[model samples]
Target: MLLVAPGPFALARTFVFRRYLTLRSHVVRPVAAPPVVDAARKARKLLKKRAKEERLRNFFGWCEGCGAYGSIF
Candidate 1:
């Protein structure tokens, strides 16, 4: 595997690449980084939760405590 040789010029190029490049700008930056996540993953989780709630609502027609089989229309 190719390695970064230990030298002043090598270190300078590394610094410039890290500082100016789009991909590694954060590598040079010091900040409170936000957590990276996929929105589609969250959406899928919410969709699953809503679907489960709908199924439960259908199964239990009315208030479980009262045992009233009334339509919530």
Candidate 2:
């Protein structure tokens, strides 16, 4: 059997090609950020909740002592 020694440039080229293949295989993509809630949408939801509570309080008599709507029979 004959032993063949690889040249310095051959080893360096192999290293560079291996490194390039590894880097190309594993690619990192930019991720999107989480969605944000604007103030107007928050305000609208708050107003809707307040209106619902107000309507419920009106339908059922408000109990100041309990701090909620209470029914009196």
Candidate 3:
């Protein structure tokens, strides 16, 4: 609603208005996995793979040396 009033000067005028605002509920949602978490997961997988390869290498090396060291291969 608006109300207009005339002022003393010919070109001067005042305006009055009323504004009504209604509040409503908003929905909240979950976000996807963070970048840091994904990076950490990838790093963990790579480390595990590297550790497994090292273990296998050590085991084979030990096996190759067993017969020459007077132990069962």
RMSD of 2: 12.2
lDDT ranking of the models: 2, 1, 3
Report lDDT per candidate.
0.72, 0.73, 0.67
Every model's TM-score:
0.35, 0.34, 0.44
lDDT of 1 by residue, 1-73 (tens): 8996688688789878866786566576766434434665778899999999999997776457356544543
lDDT of 2 by residue, 44-72 (tens): 99999999999988766644644554554
How far off is residue 48 in model 2, in Å? Answer: 0.6
Q: Which stretches of candidate 1 lie over 4 Å from their true place?
A: 1-37, 62-73
**Cα RMSD for candidates in order:** 10.9, 12.2, 17.4
Tens-digit lDDT string for candidate 3 (1-73): 8887656663432221111111111223444469977998999999999999999999999877885688543
Candidate 3 lowest-lDDT run of ten: 16-25
lDDT of 1 at 63: 55
For candidate 3, the TM-score is 0.44
Which residue pairs in candidate 3 have backbone atoms (N, alpha carbon, C) closer than 3 angstroms, thus clashing?
Answer: none
lDDT at 28 for candidate 1?
A: 65
Q: Which residue pairs in candidate 1 collide?
A: none
